[model samples]
Target chain A: MNSEILNIPLNDYKTTVESLKNEGFEMMMDLTVVDWFRKKEPRFEIVVQFLSTSHNKRKTLKTFVNDEDLSISSITDIYPSANFYEREAFDMFGIIFENHPDLTRILMPDDWVGHPLRKNYGSGRIPVQFKNAPKVD
Target chain B: MKDYKVKKSKLSNFKNKLDFWATNSEEGGWNISSTDEGSQKMLENENEEQIKIQTGTEVLDDFVIDEETSDDERMIVNMGPQHPSTHGVLRLQAELEGEVVRRVKPIIGYLHTGMEKTGEELNYFQGPTNTTRMDYLSPLFNELVFSLTTEKLIGIEVPERAKTIRILMTELNRISSHLVALATGGMDIGALSMMIFGFRERELILNFFEKTTGLRMNHNFIRPGGVAADLPDGWQKDVQEILKVIPEKLQDYDDMLLDNPIWKGRLQNVGILTTEECFAYGITGPSLRASGYSWDLRKSQPYSGIEKFDFEIPVLNEGDVFARWRVKVLEIFESLKIVEQSMHNMPKGPYKIQDKKITPPPRKRLDESMEALIHHFKIYTEGFKVPEGDAYVAIESPRGELGCYIVSDGSSKPYRMHVRGPSFCNLQALPVIMTDSPIADAVAAIASLDPVIGDVDR
Candidate 1:
């Protein structure tokens, strides 16, 4: 229940993950991004959840990413489970996973325009089209 | 890893040789250059088929590969965006060489309604309504995890009665969810009776849920501070009926499927997933337990005072479709035990926390007291503010580790809310389980994994 939270630098994210992997963290529970548009200096924060099954512990690894540089090295090499998650983060927040295999949008259509989860992207902006329904302005 | 040498199709006479593009999202449909050559080079340098099954000991005997089939007859097969067996809009593209599955890619997102985007817009109070839709089978678990995260951020505790109520409801929900998994899994493998029996038993639990939560699915009953309402009068009788009937029905399932040769043939030694593979893929719940790993979040973490009850985490070493099915069957018994204990030890107190900011005053009090009326108005309109910090709370849902991570900016609404859906993570293992197996086994593999697309595409 007592999860250790570590805020690692962007450069040290992979190294920290590797060390954690060596330190009995066999399972990567979850990976997601929180877009802090104007509130923080860095526009996005990548949050990774790791579980050490042998040690019976959980760890949360967080790293910040600037708006200008939206890419981070994918941890799919270490935790293969992160494949879909990284793609989801890419689809939602537009945070490119640098070495992700098939880094296409996993949750959105391929032709969709903007990241939906980003603060700048407004919800209910796109109108739905029905065959015989009347169109709304 | 075995290499699949695919021969070119002998249709050169045709003007255009039609290549099967599994998904429109896959190459040349929407036309996004998704292939990363640098990553490809790195993976190739490391090893082909980079999915590492890191068993400290020798791999299990069931993971035996058959004699190499001729790749000359290889073809791409797309199963389900509409197929009933895929369990809700999950599309899987498998490379098949003469009925043997070579590789699989699960193309999700058909059910993506941008719920997470909608979560950013809803406040902490309204959060459960959004989350309950994800993993629709176990709606209470989603609500519970979301509420727990919100409560953690707010730094408040519900009463003992509320905790006990939550445990009771969630355990029953687990039984219902597992019943659906068993039902659908049975239906996939040609056991029509099981589908009927599972639903018949599950209807009892859904009826109980409706009596308590007012709706069958997407209850949104379990709130941040506590449950929305107290257990309805004579709820004990409803639970007692479930406890009485489900065990009898489960015995019937065992008799029907356990020793049946055809059932065993279809499930056993098919879709083998080693513990190492499960760990690598982050597959928890029965799938991970089926692979001989005993990692249940409820027993380990003990949220919402569930540690008060006594139950066992059923584990099997087979790591095949049969083991996964059997593990779920056994888990229902354990969940039943927890539910029975919770029923006996049901506490008598408030359903929600006593804090005025978190819980609104009763309707009678609203007319009597002016302050109570004001509190209700403010709470409903503005909502209670959580402290400026983030917390992630995970619980052992029927599926797996259902976690909710919430970031608070000292506001009523969550700054960012993300759900770590176990189905989504478990779907990553489809390729590992389905590869080198027969095409028929792929259906069983998917059914055993039980990737509910609502959770995956959420």
Candidate 2:
């Protein structure tokens, strides 16, 4: 019942994850990126949701990462459930998962270039083949 | 460009050699030089090949059509991309050693439809249309979770009657969704009769839903601020009829499957999920409850006037596939009780919030007042904006703790929306469940988890 929401900053993501692992937060429900294209500097926000059965509590950790090299510590070592979700985040938002064992695409094909979930991604473009049909004048 | 032209000449020479071989073969005897139209057509085909070679810029698309099966010690077995027992388009590449599974990597997204990204592009009012498509079996649950989160962020006070009606519809949806799992799970385990019986009762429930929401599967009845419209006339009567029949049918299902030795043997102790492991995977709903953790969102944190309903959160001590099945069957009865109570205590008032900002003004008033017309147009076109904040709402859906986390930046569309789908969490236990079990049991284990690929891939 003693639950509190902690707003940890982006730099402390690794340390916070390590500490939570020590505290028996064993499950990583999801890790997703929210693209705030309208923002400056860090245009992408990473959200990690965790649950601790011993404490019967769930907490969401949010952090901002720069668009230049959007990477974060992969939590696969701590929570095996994150294996698919992190791959999905990578496939959709183009956020890289540092040290992920198999960081290949989960939702899209291996040859897909641009992430489709990014706000600026062009719509109606062919996904798998990436073939651009000639535009009519 | 000069190098490409040289390669094109060599490619033409190769094509000429292939044509010569084809013509010389007994099965493919054709005249190389003849005046017949068929021979002329063959010449024209060769001319087109010459044109392709003359272009000299065509890139030979090098694609690996079929990957050469590796001779490494790893054994590759495809669980399903199309197999019926997979529940949906879920393909798992499991690395096995003899009879033991070494590692399993699930390949999803065959059912992906860009639902989350689509939600961001659409207006807030159109959000339900996208959310309902994620978990098609439990559309009302998806819409309700999204609507509640958006409503909480927007600070709109939905009418008491609207909240009651929402609860009523969602509880019925919970039963309907569980029935789908039960029927399909039963069929997956070789009990074909159970599927027929389960669907028989489920059709009655879907009939009630169609009466109220005007749709059988994807009922977008629950919307932001409240329900889409008031319940149709005699809605209570129709719901009461279902309550009267469903409990008896559920009893018959229990009698048929609960004590059958074959069904019990296949599920009672198979795919056992320990309490510690269930918590570690953040498992919820029947799967969590079957492991002896009595956590139901309806009792822990009631929303949409669910606290007023009289129902029990069904739980079991056995953390196996059978236990999960039992928990769901018991929940059907519990839902029926809630539906009967809601029907008896049905409230009378407007079904949606009266605020012109959220709900449009009445159609009659639109003709009379210019202000009403403008408000209606604005509400429909632009949609109401939510405050810049985030809220996570969890509901005890038939599938488990179905939660929606919404982040709004004071815009008509959600800045970010994520679903804590029970199927996705429950499916995490599959690798552990199938590690030592026979390969056939893997299919039953997956079906018992009742994963909808739409939810998983999204």
Candidate 3:
């Protein structure tokens, strides 16, 4: 029932996932991207959670990714269920998943411009259409 | 119980065969051979198909629009985004060949609300309101996860009474959620009576929710340190009323759907996802339990006094729609048991935490003391700050493992707040389960997943 959290090297992230899968991390519970835009070295952190069904244990793995090199090797090879989540990360944070067969925008319109999750994205400027207002499109 | 054991052993044997086949065959994942010699030939053909996929001759990617799709053999169709049986705004693109589904690609994002980004904008005190709407059906779980994660960040503990009350409310909500699953899933497969019966039972639970939390849905009762309010007068009787009626109604639902020939035909063998498939896709909750892997966060990673409760984790090895239905119906009995235990052990104490820094002063204190008024004003406006740390707290929602990952930079607002929604992740298994099955079974498959689009797109 104990949940363990570890910080693995970015280069070893793929290997860690593979080893964890082999070690009976039967399913991935979740994968999230965190933006620490003010930090000096790493701007983004990819937090991955894997679950052992038999043991009822959870292990969370975190790896750092900077804005400059936003790419991280995909774990879809080990966990096929990570496909949608990786795509969601790509859509929200623009953190690319390398070796992902179909890495495109998900959870967002395909034509939408810029990643909306980065800290710098403007939160208030978008105009809200009222009932009486004419459609912008 | 005997039947469950037999099926579970058979499933383990099936897995061993697959493991044996995996090592012997050159083909890797997702290419399962048949039971006998059919598998030998499939191994060879699967290798060729892998080569084609590598060379771009066969674009096996599910999401893309394939140009190589021949017009003569198969045709493509979209099931929903607007269709009724879809349960929500989920679009499934199915490639069909004479009523057989080749692949079903679920197109999501129609309900996207940018909730994660909005979480960062809202301070910790307002986190529950934002998260509660993620899974509109199981809103309390969303609040629970957000609250649990925030508590982890701040290192605060709820009172014993608060924990028991949380356990009580959430267990009731679980039964309510499972009822909706039965209703919508049964309705999808053409069981109109089951839908009515399911909703009837759900109404009773929702009524109790309305009485306790002041709202039927999206009750932001749970907060970081404790719940927002205490149980209403005679609330225990309300829970006891639900406990009285649900079991009898469940019996009615079982008699109607469990042994019906048409119900069995539609859901028994339809949407079979084996244990290995669940592992590969990271699917959990009822779907995983139906697949024979008994991993529920309540049982495994106990939180909010769940460890003290005595309830069995019902599991089935069939990994089919019927198995999921059966598991959910059985789980309601266990939830009822939890409610009964909680009622017997109910305590009398303050519901919210007593700390002045965390919880606002009572309204009476505001008129009596200027310091109390100032404290309340500061707490509401600025919100209490959490130390710099990152934490992920996952709880078993009705659908699956719903997790909240929060990164705080010692600010009232979160540095980042991302939800690992079960609906979004469980939806990935759709293509795997729906492929090669009949087109009709796809409806049952999706309904069995019990995915709420709000949770998927949040």
Candidate 4:
């Protein structure tokens, strides 16, 4: 077991990815977008969580992407499980995963019109189609 | 199978009649006039105070229609939305040929409560309520991940006593979560005795939890800076009593199933997940550990003062149903060790952070100090704002590496929140595991995976 795992900064995503690749980090566990609406230029941030089984190390790579075009290089080729996660990001946050195979909605249907996780997304109550409505209290 | 086909067609025709009645009844005139004589006759016979009846039998009929038209060459089996074995509203559409499952597509979203979006709208203090809903069975771990991330982002130092209490509660929750998985998983695979044993032991743990957190299931005790309140008196004694009793109960469980030929036959060499595959699917906790990977957040990252306690990360090379079960069972012992150590090293200090901005003043000071009263009023009305930053925190939950990613724009509420639910990720491997396996074995595979549908759907 390694004595210490390094905490890399968010600015050096490309370098960190290359370093992790060199260090035998073969799996990209999860990729998600966190929207920091208070930030000036790039209000949205992307978190790339990785796991290296050989070295038994886990690292989170963070980066800021503009809300105008939320795009990230696809890690599906590196880790097949990433396909669904990236598709989920697209479905929930409107972040586009470039070069991802089968990059359609995985959880929600294809026709789901809006990204539900964004800060500005309206929270319209979905009408209950069942007999007993949920208690109002 | 032949009998089902005949009944299914009859049910579909009945459903068509029901739909026609519903739609045509709204169109007025002709439809109402045609049915008026029969309706009037029925109304006259019925009592005035009789309750109106609506049948969910239509839903059952619709499912039969969906089953019949699905395809003849393939056998379509619906595994739960209500079935006890699916572990909570998870429905699977499995295509089978005889006993072998050809393909399985998991149909989720039955438990969708929009928790991630709800977290964004709620303030930091109220965030635990949303977290508690994700993994309802293991709510403390959900609260732990969110609280840890918020604390890291804001850079607040939780008191030593609070940290020790957090570790104790977290380990206890882990044991409870494993017991639930064991109970439900065993029942899924047709082991009735194991289910009873698992739940019996689980009730003891939940009893201990109720004493500390004031709730059995959704204990919103852990918060951003620290725990909600100080440990109740004699808490250490209760924990020690549980620690002393659980070891023997766990051994009884092992005797009942671990070496039994029937249990071994069903679990061994079933649903094999390779090391590469486990990593690819982002599998963690006991599931990943079973694949011979010794990755545990408590040992590796050491959040909430977990480094103070010593415990082993159990690993198995088989990576099958039995191996996963073994890892979880062994983890119960290790969690007990952590809990014992945490109790021994319990410190004395304030439970929550002392900052008036983050934590409200004590009730006694509200009447004494004007500043305390003002601070309490402000914090409750407009919650403390987090810094403008983002952080992702992951914990070794019973099922896997449950993670939370939060972004705060210096506001009381999170701008955006996303959960890296292990069940959601681990469930993706179901299709891979079920292919070519016997349809019965698919249930065992899913049971061993222990995918909670609430976590998956959220």
**Each model's total of backbone clashes:** 0, 1, 0, 0
Per-residue lDDT of model 1, residues B84-107, tens digit only: 999999888777777777666778
- Candidate 1 deviant stretches above 4 angstroms: A132-137, B1-71
Kindly report the TM-score of the first chain in candidate 1.
Answer: 0.95
TM-score of model 2 (CA atoms): 0.83
User: What DockQ would candidate 2 receive versus the native complex?
Assistant: 0.36
Model 3, runs deviating above 4 Å: A129-137, B1-71
Best-fitting candidate, scored by TM-score: 1
Report lDDT per candidate.
Answer: 0.85, 0.75, 0.83, 0.77
lDDT, model 3, position A41: 62
Give lDDT tens digits, candidate 4, residues B157-187. 8888888888889899999899989988889
Question: What lDDT tens digits, residue by residue, belong to model 3 across residues B1-458?
Answer: 99999999999778767865656532334343332211111112223322222221121222334567676768878676789888789888777876777755677888888998899989999999999999999999999999999998998889999999999989899999999999988898899888898899899999988988999999999998899988989887888789999999998888887889989878887778777777777788999899898888898788888999999999998888889989999999999999999999987788888988789988899999999999999999999999998888888888888889898999999988989888888888887777766787888988999999999998
- Model 2 chain A scores worst on lDDT over the 10 consecutive residues at A127-136
Reference-based lDDT, residue A32, model 2: 73
Mind giving the per-residue lDDT tens digits that candidate 2 earns over B1-458? Answer: 99999999999777766666755432322443332321101111223322221111211111122245344645867677788888888877675555545445466667777777777777789889888888888899999999988888887778888888888888888888889899999899899987898788889879988888898987788999788878888887788778888888887887888789988888866676766666656677788888788878788767888888777887798877888888888888888888888888878888888776788787799879999888888888898888997777777777777878788888888877888777877776776666545566677778777898888876
Query: For model 2, what is the C-alpha lDDT against the true structure?
Result: 0.75
> Listing candidates in order, what is each one's chain A TM-score?
0.95, 0.82, 0.90, 0.75
Provide the lowest-lDDT 10-residue window in model 4 chain B.
B52-61
Better of 1 and 3 by DockQ: 1
